[model samples]
Target: MRTLSRECGVTDADNPWLSRPVAPQPSAPAYTGAPTARPTGPSAPQRGVPAPDRAALLPTIDQRQDADLWWLGAHGGAGETSLAALIPGWPAAGHGWPRTPGAAPARVVVTARSSMSGLRAAQTSATQWAAGLVPHVQVLGLVLIADAPGRLPRPLREFAQVVAGGFARTWTLPWIEAWRLGEPPALTAAPREVRRLVDELSALLRPGADGTAN
Candidate 1:
């Protein structure tokens, strides 16, 4: 795995926010257990923010089960919906954090494209989360969806490096041609990297698994 801190000269000695990368561990079984629920109550809305449509909320795969993590989009068309459907978890989709009165996972993963603007939005969200501006949600890391197929341009790659440097961990998903055509993702049809990412994330949600939290 390519770590941005090492490549960008962001040692812990120079930057307090940067830390040593955790080594990847062996795979574990995927967790199919339901997430625990938390206390439910009416949440007061922020003064200026408009209330999101609760009716439009994406239906959870199992209403009885809670989510292991909440996926939030860093910007529009950041593949949040697709990923939420592809991956096993609750998707916030640019709306605020999950506020449904139940046990919800505090861990959050933000998604964005590999483009400059997407990276900037992701960086800002990560920065805000790191500074504790986003209450109740702990940003696990970033998930960058490739803007296109093949290698990225030098400028975009450099920008991604800088953005990745700001977070302890980041996962990059390659462009999927089938997805653009509106096909559902299947494990057997996914790329090796995509499978690896899913396995890593699954390990994280399972108890006693050797998954690292960034």
Candidate 2:
């Protein structure tokens, strides 16, 4: 906002009515304030700005639901849709925390791929849940979808083991060629592991903390 200042001319001693032209005064020395604040350390976030790690996290679903369990995706291609198709009526919250109405805690099973990046995303989600970033949310476990046709590389498998400890239990899914070919998961026969997942998740979907399924 550029405000226009009307500077009334200084009154002249010689003439009372007519305005007088004043000589320009010397410029004042610049008043320097304290040395510029050092850029905040990595631990300290800037004012009104979110931390880098927090900012990097994907936005969570805003809609609230009171359901048995939510498939919380770790990334964009975390296979939320296909899994949802397999278990019809279950809601999916992509890369975001699932919300439940009132004081009800959201029941979540984090989903991601078995690849390096996918596992990393899953790690972030697990870390967030472990850190209690959102209170009253229960992270039941993790479900790692096969990233390719073969077994995961040794490094990824090891890293996955580390990430799995963040949650209670972890489930693995084999790669489905039919899903890749655009076939609906619900129509195709689910693998034994997938069926086990469905059954175990169904049993573990209880809203109580005590006496959960193994």
Top candidate on TM-score is 2
| Weakest ten-residue segment in model 1 by summed lDDT | 37-46
lDDT of 2 at 180: 91
Per-residue lDDT of 1-214 in model 1, one digit per residue for the tens? Answer: 1243353343444443432012442323355443322112111112222222334222222223345666778778887777766554444544444443454435667788998888877766654554344455555667899988999999888878677655546789899898889998666687876676666666565665433332
Over 50-107, each residue of candidate 2 has an lDDT whose tens digit, in order, gives 1127754656565654656678888888988788766544667766787667466666
Alpha-carbon lDDT, every model: 0.58, 0.60
Residue 30, model 1, lDDT: 58
For candidate 1, what is the lDDT? 0.58
TM-score of each: 0.66, 0.70
How well does candidate 1 score on lDDT at residue 177? Answer: 91
Cα deviation in Å at residue 196, candidate 1?
A: 0.9
